[model samples]
Target chain A: MAKVLMKGNEAIGAAAIKAGCKYFFGYPITPQNELPEYMARELPNIGGVFLQAESEVAAINMVYGAAGAGARVMTSSSSPGIALKQEGISYIAGAELPCVIVNIVRGGPGLGGIQPAQSDYYQATRGGGNGDYRHLVYAPATIQETVDLLMEAFDVAEQYRNPVMVIGDGMIGQMMEPVEFKEPKKRPIAPKTWSTDGTKGERKPNIINSLYIDPQELEDHVIRLENKYAEMKENETRYENYNVKDADVVVVAYGTTSRVVKNAIAKCEEEGIKIGLIRPITLWPFPDKAFEEITDRTKGILTVEMSTGQMIDDVKIAINGRKPVHFYGRTGGMVPIPDAIVEEIKKISGGVK
Target chain B: MLKDNRIRVITGHYGSGKTEFAVNYAVKLAGVNKKVAIVDLDVVNPYFRSREKEGFLSDLGIRVIGSSIKGASSDLPAISGEVLTPLQDETFEAVLDVGGDPIGARSLGRYHEYFQKGKYDMLFVINANRFETQTKEKTIAYLKNIEVQSRAKVTGLINNTHLLRSTTIEDVLRGQELCKEVSEELNVPIRYVSCIENVAKELPKDIEGEIFPIKMYMREDWMS
Candidate 1:
């Protein structure tokens, strides 16, 4: 409703509030502590609930509790914190609850530094938590995108009756930029039909859970999740193509690093370095088809990241090595400067004599 | 401390509770009627910092400036707001809360000229367990890199290493010892060692410097 300067984390929190998310449960973790803190302050004013749970595990369970009561719910944490929440997330997904999870990722495999990183690409896309379930994943590169996608995530989660994740990194969370809040759209009231509200006349008691002892029933549930994922692949794929027309080199990146790659492309354009960017907005259902088309036009594809080339593996798979695919990145939360990216582009294009 | 308005740089490793310390210190200064402002220059990490609580700081009459998501694109002109004006003014006291690690410190390069123009104090927050530099020597080396990039001298040390959920008194003492060792070795003053009150009670009497309490938002009695 108002034009405000907001960081990516704040934007997501605001969007969630506007999108009728009345319940937020989260633990403080970097590069995403802002989201929870924002919620803690704002939720009370809106007659909503915010709980800083004991741990990430406890926070996810609180989300599960809120979602079960048919309240729009959300939880946020960084890579390591998200790892701890995976158990609850997996359970939430199995129960087909509608909830939004935000992961402002940092470098990881362990307790990583609180710097922007894209190492969680595989984790977010391939399912960070275990199970035969898939959470609808939206990877937002900009603060505005973070808000927009967070809103979209709620709708997607409700539509599929599953969990949705708005995956970003430290860069998006910390950066403050101007954003105009879109006019609030009319949101559907929380679906009370199947929720576990107190049993009333003509309605049976509703139980939402991941536990199913029957082998056939579990198989049926797995099949349902698989079908939902397949449908998402067909209908929910999102990506952005930048200056891709007749490009010699295509750079593939997502989240914060994509912006850096785009800047590098612009810089290189001055020197007649024709490079393009394919930024995947949805990391899950990774835009393989989009890269396939770009590969045909470009001589080679490069994946840039703030990690040790984690997303490059996915790019290689997407291209199937039909065109030369290269990896350029800095690990341990080190972001490649535009100059370094330009150098790599020159090396790949043979523009450097 | 020089009277010519200077930008103070505060930094530390992640989970070091540097954000809490910065917020408290900034608020404490403002409470004493100082014309204070804090620039959240921590773009490296997303979660725990003054930037994350910009609204809170702004509410307290302290200006909080930082790069937003829109500025994530390097092509976008760095649009600093009114906070820059006060930093340049001689009457204002500004604190720059640099991000968790070296990458966060890198952002200080842009404000190097401002630091050079005025008196500045760069405080390196040390947590004993974080980074590859767990010991004093390694921590100093890390701080040196930060100083080289930010062009600001590390004038003080604030030891704040503690486990998030299970912090004990022993941990704070260990942090104090490390801070003392680093202070003596680097010839830097130990400004204040941060500790949660629960753990601060068990701290030995020999630990130097004033003890600052960490106020986390999660605590139910935070307002009290």
Candidate 2:
């Protein structure tokens, strides 16, 4: 279709539909409310299902049920709501069901604010639910990127038989931008021969359960999950590097903050400072390899986030003491401006240790 | 810069971008040395209020009179002391960015005394793309409701019909037809046909109404 000027939430809904997702379960929340509203109005007309569950928790379990039945399903919510769905997400992950969960993150600890925030970095990357399980997390910088990532999120979920989380802050959820819906690629998915849809009295009933009373079987499942994660880390780690080949200070950010940092980098460049941006598109894999290419010209790393120093931990871990990593962040729904990030770049270059 | 009205009230249904238009109009007025003060009368929407751009507008020498607390997310209509400045001072061409819908326009009832003496034009900004007021009949209904709550007459219409990036010259033309219907029925003059300046520069010149080319300063995180 032609390029449409759509809010990030609306684009996510359109993209999900284009990706052949007919089942959507969601609850009303600020910033990301457009997604459910879009689904509610359009899904029914297209011979699909859009159900507003009683709560976020209920929504996710519905996603788990639909996914188990070999139907592509999704559920979306903001940060607090995402928190409520964590248990269901854990259950879905443990059960190895392929589904998509979108977290249009808002400021948080407990109902912190309704504004945009990337505070859920740790929550998203670490899997909000309990278990030694990891699902791929994709962080998008633009509305267009959010659409593209959500389309890929479903395939990635089914390909790995894991629930994938597509995450963005309120800014990415609320802002209007031009987005082109490309023709959905014909994804090659493994046949759901293991689904519990029905046996038709053919063979033994397939049981999709997470609980393992026996220790060995549980350990085997853990090993299998670990192996799958390892494969994803090797094959699915994604990142975008800008002007990093010969830079003195490299700035790391993701989602909406990355856009601001890009403007900061441009401002810094005019002042004869060589700065670069390392935006992590897939926050899960963390793009550890991107750090290896940070050239000898690089002196220090600055991680800018909308939260108080969450993603910095990952940057420091990836850098591994080779360089001092500085952190600049605005928390509790305060967004970082280009001028502030530019000032941070100046401070980093001036040896503000 | 407003020819007939020194005090202008911009109102519309939700998502019609009345605030965005108000901000741009005030900025344009301030650019030409006409003393401008924008009163953020919108207490309905917590996001995308003109008050949030106070720092930027203040830098341009335009007075931004908003809520007492800077950058407040509260929905309460806590009127600042500075909101009354436009009523007394005839030199300052003030623009009231009223909240969307009738409930938001209710606050204007308190300013009824000042609006009687002061030359004012309440422009109802219309976007044909919004679901509530997409049709000409629905637009007229919205206008009537706003007029009822505010207890003020709407003197003009600003056709700001767009679909964000997908807005075409055809969308503008289609919206003009809707505005013509409203204009003939309500007898309110159509002020300006607005689109983004980029699109305005590309129109095929087959439409009606004076083009108010808009350049947005308040934008998404990625737009920067």
Candidate 3:
């Protein structure tokens, strides 16, 4: 297929359709409105379902219903909107129904602002809903990568019978870039035999519920979820290593921040500084293995983000105090520029040297 | 510089480089010592609207009119009454940076009377690399939709096709081919072939429209 320029939000909608997703339920929100709008305009043409629910809360429940019935479903919202859907997300995860949820993150403890920010890192990786449930989370740095991951998000969700998140800051939702919908690598996916589709008296009806009232049954269910999460940690962990070997300073970042960090690393290189980067593609699995690339020459680890160091906690755990971790960030919808990141890298490198 | 009419309305698909073309055309009009006012009638897209560059364009003596809401992050679909100033007054050579779809173009529907009363050139911008406008048929569908929604006929066509930093001469030519087809089909003339200077220099002179070199006003160096 020929490459065409597309905004990140529209590309996501197109990718979801290409991935065989036919049901979309979402509400309007800044930076991510294009995704729902695209789905609304195009879905009907393809005999797919697109509904603008009353609110984010209502939308996720709609997603829940569709996913339970063995349909590839999706819903998207920004930070605050994602917060509203947390309860439903928890239910989806607990029910072990496959679905995709996209968060084109904006700054927020509340309705913060419409510009890009990664403050929701904790909310995404730590599971915003109440439960011992964990789901797959993918953070793509580029629009092409965003579409590619979106195409695969459904397969991964169905394979594990778990919810999958494809998150990017508002930049990834709004920015335009050339993209081609490439087919993802084939994965071994089990049939949706566990779905609540009617049995027509041929077999016992499948029940979809997150509740296990008995304490032992609940414990067993929790352990089963844990094992699924363990499998995901083993198989789905993805990270990118750039110029990591023999570097004076290593930087860890993801999504839009990682792109800025790459530019900063290039600028540092011109000043006789060797800087390496570990870009986490999956925020959940956290890419702890990428830290092994930090060599003896590495002075310290620097984490850059659009938020004020939310991902720093994961970085600390990943490094496990093996190297000093430094942080540089901009919040309230402010994006970290390359020069600012370079200065922080210099500051960390200077202290260790 | 579109001197064919006092009011130049720029419309196209979102990401079709309509805002970029409007900014460049406004700057060129200002360069010629003409009094210019650039009205940002784009309420559909929250990001990268011409209103975001108000300060930069203001310093160049181009008056910028945008949403009544002030803050940068506010996504309210509000347009200020000041937008009508350029349309009412004949002294200013105005550039209207309209939103990119049929729904977005509806913002201009309210001012249909003013457009019809005054001499206006509604230039429909085209980017062949854009998904919806990739083919002649698709491009015509969008063009016809914009016209119906805006309640205004497209007076001119602009081949402002690009892939941002990755744009090449061939990409611009591809846009030209689509624009030429649309022009022939609709009887609207191709008015400008817009692109960055490096790519603009490589375009063949036989192309239908005049080459208009543009700077990266809306896009930043770090965007790619």
lDDT of 1 by residue, A1-353 (tens): 42344557777888899887899988897667768877998999999988888888899998998888888999999999988888898899898888999888887779867777878877776776777877777888767778887887787788778899988877778765445556444445446577887886767789988899999999998998899889889988899988776788888988777877777887888888789889988888788878755645567888888877667777888888688888898866666777788888887887822
Cα deviation of B161 in candidate 3 (Å)?
A: 1.8
> lDDT tens string, model 2, B1-224?
45848889999986687988899999889888888999999866556789889889999998998887665545456878778898679888999999888888998888887776348989999987765677888899999999999999998898888876567877777778899899999988888788898878876565555678887766754472
Q: Write the per-residue lDDT of candidate 3 for residues B37-124, one digit (tens) a residue.
A: 9999988888888988999999999999999999879888899999889999999998999998999999999999878634898999
Model 1: colliding residue pairs: A31-B46, A31-B47, A32-B47, A33-B47, A175-B67, A175-B68, A175-B69, A176-B67, A176-B68, A177-B68
> Clash pairs of candidate 3?
none
Best by DockQ: 3
Q: Candidate 3, which segments miss by more than 4 Å at Cα?
A: A351-353, B116-118
Ranking by DockQ: 3, 2, 1
DockQ of 3: 0.78
- Considering every candidate listed, which one attains the maximal TM-score? 3
CA shift of B92, model 2, Å = 8.8
Name the docking class for model 3: medium
- The lDDT-based order of candidates, best leading, equals 3, 2, 1
Worst 10 residues of 3 chain B by lDDT: B112-121
